[model samples]
Target: MNDVNVYTVTRLTRDIRLVLEDTFQAVWVEGEVSNFTVSSAGHTYFSLKDESSLLNCVMFRGNSGRVGFTVKDGMQVLCYGRVSVYDKRGQYQLYATKMEPRGKGALQLAFEQLKEKLYKEGLFDEANKKPLPFLPMHLGVITSATGAAVRDILKVARRRFTNIKISIYPVRVQGDEAKHEIARAIEELNEYNRHIAETGGEYPVDVIIVGRGGGSLEDLWPFNEEIVAREIYASEIPVVSAVGHEIDYTISDFVADLRAPTPSAAAELVIPLKHDLTVRINEYRDRLYLSIKTKTEMLEKAVKTSRDRYVLRAPMNVFLQMRQQVDDLLRTAVSGISHSLELKQRDLGTVTGKLQALSPLAVLERGYSITFKDGRIVRDAGLLEEGDILHSRLSLGRVTSRVEHVG
Candidate 1:
C-alpha cells in the first residue's frame, strides 16, 4: 500500500482558511468604508474600498469604543488589524485593532503623531525658544537649492537690507530623502556656528530660516516631520519657519523660535529696512546741525554783548576814572610827606629848647653868676683861708678874687 493518505476536501479547505486568516490578521489598509453594518452580537462589518479595490473588514466592540470619531459608510479611514478566516463561513476579513478618519494622509498622520509626542516632551516649548538678534550680520537658509522659496527670500532680503550676508545649505524639500537632508543641514549649520565661535571667527549665522514654498500637504510633508522639528528645536541660532502659506501650518512652525507666514515675510522680519534707517540717520543729522547752530548763535550774541560792554562803550570815561585814581594816590602821598615833615620840625624845636635850657649862655642871660677862689669856682662859702684870692665868674667872663673872712 502507498504511504500517502488523502484527507477530506472539507479539511483541506479549513487548513487553507487558517493560513489566510493569519495573513489578514497582521495587515493594515486604508480606504473608504462602505456598506457598514452592525450585527446583533455587537460586531461591526464594513467593506474597505479604494477607487479600484475593496476588502471586507470587521471591528469588535472593544476596538470600536477606542475609535476617535463615529464610523460611518462612505467615510475614508485607516484600519489596522490582522487577516482572519471565519471558521463558520470560511470567509477572510480584516480584524481591526484600530481605526481613524482618513483626514490626514499616512505621511501627515505620522508627522502629527510625532509632533504631538515631541510637544509632550517639551521640545516645542516657548520657554526654550531662542531670541533672534535684532541686527544679524549673517543668515543661514536651509531649503532646496533650486526651489522658489530661496529665490523669494533672497529677493526680499536684498531689497530690504543690502548688507545682509546669506549662507545657503541646500537640501531636498520633499520626497523620501527630504527629512534627513533638512535635519542634516540644520545640524551642520549649528556645528559650523559652534566652530566659528570656538575659533574666534565671526559668528556663523545670527538666524536661520528653514522651509520651502507652499505646496500640497504631501509635498510639504518633510517640514512637518519629527526629525526636522527636533533639529529646529535644538539649533542654537534662532530659527524662523516659513513653510507653506498663511493658512498652512507645519510642525517646524510650532517648534521654531519664530514663524512667518511666507518666505518673503520671513525675509522682511529678519532684515531691517534700509530706507527707514536712512531717514532716521538724516533726522539725527539735522537735529545735530540745529543744536550746533543754536549754540553758535547764543555764543555769538554773548561775544557781541561783551564787546559792547559799559567799559568798552565809554573809553574816555574809563580813562578819566583811572586818572582820578592816580590823582588821589598822588594827593595821599603829598599829604603823608607834609605831615611827616611837620612832626619832625616839632620834635626838632623841642630838642632845641631843651638844649637852650641847659646851656651856660642861657644861664648868663638869666642873670646867674659863678664865683671862684684861687682860680676855682667856690661851691661852698664855709671854708676860706685868710689872704686867699677869689675869682668871680659870670655867664660872659671870669674874675679873680681873694678871701678875707671865714664864716
Candidate 2:
C-alpha cells in the first residue's frame, strides 16, 4: 500500500493526450463518415466507423478549409490526421487535416461538386450562351503558347481561311496556379474586346478558343475549375471549349457556348472554307448577270415592236392627225354654240309674241278703255255706285271721275 503513488486527474489526462498523439501521428484512416456535423466555430466533427469499430474525428477551422469537400453522413472517406486524446472528455480522437471521398478521385469529386453548384445557378443554360460568328475575322486563343494545341489550331485556321486573324493570350493550362492564369486570360481578352468597342475599332476578336491538348484528368483540371467555368460564362465573346480528345470532357465544356472535340476542330468551326465562300459568291454573280441579260433582251424586243407601229414610224404624220382631230373638235363646238344661241333667240321671240297677245295695252290701243271703281274693275253695271270714285284707263291716258249713274 505504501509503494503506490497518488496522481491527479488533470495530469493523467494530459499525459494520455500527448502519448496518443505521438503514437499515431500522421495516420491514414479509411471508413464511412457517420454523425457528421460542423460546429458554430467552423470545426467539423464526425465519426469514422466501419462495421465493427468506430473512431471520433475532428477537423478544426484551419484544416477544414483545406479538406476541399463537404463532409456528410454515410459518405465513405479516406482521412489523414494525428491521433490524440481530448483531455476534457478524456477520450481519444483523430485530428484530421485532409479528407477525400473513398473509391473516387478527390479532384474528380471536386469537379462534380462544382459542376452541380454551377448548374443549379444556371451557368450552363443554353439561353446564357452566345452564338459564334459564322465568319469571325479575328479569334482570341487562351492556352499555353508553346503547346501543341496552339500549333494545331493555328495550322487548321490558316488552312481553312486565308485572311483570318488570331490573337494568342498565353496561359498555363495545368498545375496548382493554372486555373487562375486561365481565368485572368479570359477576363483580359474580354476587357480588350470592350476597349475595342469603346474605341469604335473594327475587327476585334469575335470569338475565343479556351482549351488545351489531350492529357490526363490532372493535366486538364484547370479547365474544370470553377473560376474558368464562370469566366467562360461571363465573357461577352463566344467561347469554344476544346480541352482534350473526343473522349474527355471538363466543366469548361459544359459552360462554353460551343464545345469542339479538339483544338483543331475549334479552328475549323470558327472560319468556313475560303473555297466554299468563293463558289457561293460566284454563283450569285452569275445569277444576277443572267437575269440582267434576259431583262435587257426583253426590253430591246419591246422597243423594236413599238417602232413597227404606224404612229411611231411616222412621227410627223401622227402629229398632223392629232392636229386634224383638234380642228374638228373646234368646228363641232362652234356649230353647237351657234345652234344653242339661235334656239334661245327663237324662244325669246315666241315668248314676246305671246306676251303681246295677252297684253291689255293691245285692247286699249283698239279704242277700248277699262273702268275701275274702288280699285276694282267694274265688270258689271250693278257694280257702279253713285258718288263713288271711278278711274278709266285708255291707250294713252287715265281718266279720274265720280260715278253719277249706272247704265
Candidate 3:
C-alpha cells in the first residue's frame, strides 16, 4: 500500500455538514415531538420522532412565538427549516422556522390552515355576515347551470313560489377554473347590487345561492379552496352555501351566512310552500266572512227593533194624542182672548170720561169767557191795541171782530 493518510472523523463530518447545509436551503419535516425542553436563554431543544426513527430539533424563541398554539412533547407537528450540524455535539438537528400541528389529513390540514389565516384577518367573523332576506323576489344562483343542483333548486322554488325569478350564473364547480369563476361570479353579483342601488332599479337578486351538487372530497375541492371561501365571506348579499353532502363541510360553508344541507333544502329555505300559504289565506278569508256576517246580523237586528218601536207601529194612537193636546190649547187661547177684550173695554170708558171732564167746553159751561185777536186767542190784555183786528171764541163757535178802543 502507498502512504495511508490518517484523517480525523470530525474534520470529514464538518466538511460534509457544510456541503449539505449549502445544498439544502430549508425543508419541511413532520413528526411527533419528544424530550422537549426550554432553556432560560430562550432556546428550545427537542427530539422529533415517528414510529420508525427520530431526529433532534431546535426552535429559538423568536420563531416559537410566531406559532399560535403551544408546542409540547408528543405533539405531532410539521416544522419548516434547514438541517445543520451542532459543532459542539457533532450531531445534526432541524432549525425550525415555522411549526404547526400535523397528522390531520391533507384536506383537514389545508382547511385548518386557511381558517386560521382568515380568522386572523377577520374574514370569518359573525359580524361580517349579512342577514338573509325574508322574501327574495329574485334569487341569484352561482353554480353549473346545467347541473342537477340547478334543476333541483329551480323545481323546488318554482313549485313553492311560481312567481319567483331565478338568475343562474353558470361556472365550473371543480378543478382549477372553479375557484376563479366562483370568485368572479361573487364580484359580478356585488357589482350588480351596486348598479341597481345607484339606478334606483328593482334589485335583480335578493339572496345568493353559491353551491354545487354533492360529490366526494376531491370532486368538491373547489368549494374548500381559500379563494372561494374568501369571496363568499366578502359578498355583500347573503350567501347560502350548499356544497357537498350534508356531512361534508367545506371552507365556504364555514364562512357563509347560512349553510344548506342540500341544493333542494336551499331552495325550500329561500321560498315558501304555495299549498300551505293557500291554506292560511283560506282560513283568514273564513274569519273575515264570519266577522262581517256577525256585524251585519247585529245591524239588521237593530233596524228591525227600531221598525217595531211604539212610534213607528202605532201611528194612529200618536196622532190622536197630538190632536187632543192641540184642541185643549185652542180652547184655552179663546178664553184668554175674550177676557182681555172685556178688560180693554172698561179701560176705554174710564179714559173717555176723564177726557170729557178736562175739556174747554166744560169750562165754558161754568161761565168762563175767551178773547181773540187776529184769529187767535188773546194771551195778554196788553197785546190788544186800539184799531187792531181781533177774534173771539165761545165754547161752541168762534167770532171775528176789529178792536176800536183800548181796554
Candidate 4:
C-alpha cells in the first residue's frame, strides 16, 4: 500500500479522459442515435449505439449549429469527434464536432426536415397567402445590389410600366450571414410600410420581392433557412419569391404570396403594360360616347314623330272640333226644352177648359143664374123667409133684392 499510488475520483476521471481523448482524437463513428435531447442552451445530448455497445455523446451549441440536419432518436448518423470524460458524472462520452445523416447530404436533410416542420405548422397553406396587388405602385426588393436578378427585374419593370417605384434593399444572397441579412431586410421593409400607413405618408411599398439569380442548392441555402421563411410568411405586404429558374424551389417560395420563375417574370406579373391600360380606357370611352349618342338620336326621333302627329301639328283644329261638339249639344238641349214647353202649354189649356166646365160660372154663362140669401146659396125655396133679403148672381152681374113670397 505504501508503494502503490492512490488516485482521487477527480484524478481518476481526468487521467481516463486524457487517455481516451488521445487514443480516439478526431475519429469518425457510425451508429443509430437514441436518447437524443437538446438543451435550452442549444447543446445536443444523445447516445449512439451499435449492435453490441452504446456510446454517450454531446454537442455544444457552437458545433451543433454547423451540423446542418436535426438529430433525432433512431436516426442513423456519422459523427466525428474525440472521446472525453465528464468530471461531474464520472462518465466517458463523445464531444461531437460534426454530425451528418448517413445516406443524405447535410443541407438536403436539413431542408427536408424544416420543410416538413413548417408545412405541418400551416405556414404553406394557401389561406395564409395574401393576394398580390393588381398594380403595385411601389415595390421593395431584397437581393444583391450587383446581381443579375436586380438588373432583370428593373429592366422588365421599366419596360412594362415606367412609373413603377422600386426601393432596393441590398443584402448578401449567399454565405453564412445571408440568412440574417435577408430576414432583416424583410422586417425593415415591413416596418417601413407600417410607418407610412400609420402616419399617412407617401410611397408605401405595396409588394416585396425577395430573390436571387439561379444557382446550386448550396448557393441558394440562405433562402431555405427558417429565419427567412418566417419573415416572408409574416410580412404585411405581399411577397413575391423569385429565387431561381423554374426548376428550383426554396422554402421561401412556398411561404411567399406568389412565386415567379424569374425576377423578370415577377416584374411582368406585378406590372401591367401602360399602353394596354390606355387602350382599354379609350375603348370604354368610345363605347360610352356611342351609347349616349344613340340614346339622344332615339329621343330626337321620338320628339319629331310626336310633333308630326296631326293633333300636335294643328292644335287649333283640335280646339275647334271640341267647340263644335259643345255647340251641337247646346242646340239639342234648347230644342228639347222648346218641345217640352209646347206640350206643357197644350196640357195646361186642356186642364183649364175642364176646370171651367166644372165651375158654376159655366151654368151662369148658359143663362142660368145662382141665388143667395144671407151670404148662403138658396138652393131650396122652403129655406127663404118672406122678408129675407136675396142676391142673384148672373153671368154678367150680381143683383140684390128683398124677398116677398116664399113660393
Best by lDDT: 4
How close to the true structure is residue 309 of candidate 1, measured as C-alpha lDDT?
92
lDDT of 2 by residue, 53-106 (tens): 999999999988766555679989999999988888888999999998999878
Question: Where does candidate 1 stray beyond 4 Å?
Answer: 1-77, 80-115, 123-125, 295-407
What is the full ranking by TM-score, best candidate first? Answer: 2, 4, 1, 3
Question: Weakest 10 consecutive residues, lDDT, candidate 2?
Answer: 63-72
Better of 2 and 4 by lDDT: 4
Whole-model lDDT, model 2: 0.91
- Could you list the CA RMSD of all candidates, in the order they appear? 18.9, 5.5, 14.4, 12.8
lDDT for each of the candidates?
Answer: 0.85, 0.91, 0.85, 0.93
What lDDT does candidate 3 reach at residue 173? 96
C-alpha lDDT of residue 345 in model 4: 100
Which ten-residue region of model 3 has the weakest summed lDDT? 103-112
Model 1 TM-score, 2 decimals: 0.54
Tens-digit lDDT string for candidate 1 (1-407): 38887766678668877887665557778899999988888788899998798888889987775553456788788889888767677676788988877775555556667777888999878899898887898999998889899999999887888898999999999997899999999999989988998999975789999889999987888887777888888888899999989998988899999999988889999998989989999999999999999999999999999889988899899999999999999999999999999999999999999999988778877888877665576788776777877777677787666666777
Ranking by lDDT: 4, 2, 1, 3
Q: Candidate 4, residues 1-407: lDDT per residue as tens digits?
A: 99999999999999999999899999999999999998999999999999999999999999998887778889999999999899999999999999989999888999999999999999999999999887789999999999999999999887888999999999999999999999999999999988998999999999999999999999999999999999999999999999989899999999999999888888888888888988999999999999999999999999999999999989999999999999999999999999999999999999999999999999899999989887888889998888888999999999988888977
Backbone clashes in model 4, listed as residue pairs: none
TM-score-best of 1 and 2:
2
How accurate locally is residue 218 in candidate 4, as Cα lDDT from 0 to 100? 91
